[model samples]
Target: MLDVCVITGEDGPHTALVISAGGVVSDAVAPPGTPHLRPETITLLSALLIGDWAVADASPDGARIEARGIVAAYAQFHLERSIRSLGHIDRTE
Candidate 1:
């Protein structure tokens, strides 16, 4: 149940790449001509998502950066969700 979102650029839309033990699902909403992620990139992202630092660290610089960016975006998204959900908590005694 690992979800990774990579922010392509300031004006570009984000791409969602989901990886599960069962299989991989991608919501790549990029422009028409945009290329899909490379296999190495996916491997690096999986390693980063599952906390396999050895594999992640051994990846190429570009792949590592891309994967880390995706991981960071995913973390930020979850953090925002957590913060928003806090507003729904019952605070009364």
Candidate 2:
């Protein structure tokens, strides 16, 4: 299962999308009164995930930038986590 958190804009609220192993998406968690994601946004997210730079670049600048930021941040977070785990292993050895 993969949980993706998307922030619509720089100051926008966060929406979490849960994707299962079989590629089923569900459990979108957003604040009360938050509207559903636009089709364009979903397409942009899909494009970014699949490394479709052309499609991703066609999205609105703000949306594209925000999506890229989210992806970068997620990568950085996991990288740091992996580094920390390696440190722990080194100490244990």
TM-score against native, each model: 0.45, 0.42
Candidate number of the best TM-score: 1
lDDT of 2 by residue, 1-93 (tens): 122343222222323432211121333434444334445666687786788999987798666555544454455565654333433432221
Q: Could you give candidate 1's per-residue lDDT for residues 45-89 as a string of tens digits?
A: 668668999997788877755655555545557565434454474
Each candidate: what lDDT? Answer: 0.51, 0.47
> Model 1 segments beyond 4 Å from truth?
1-35, 49-52, 81-93
Cα shift from native, residue 11, model 2 (Å)? 27
Model 2 regions more than 4 Å off:
1-39, 81-93
lDDT of 2: 0.47
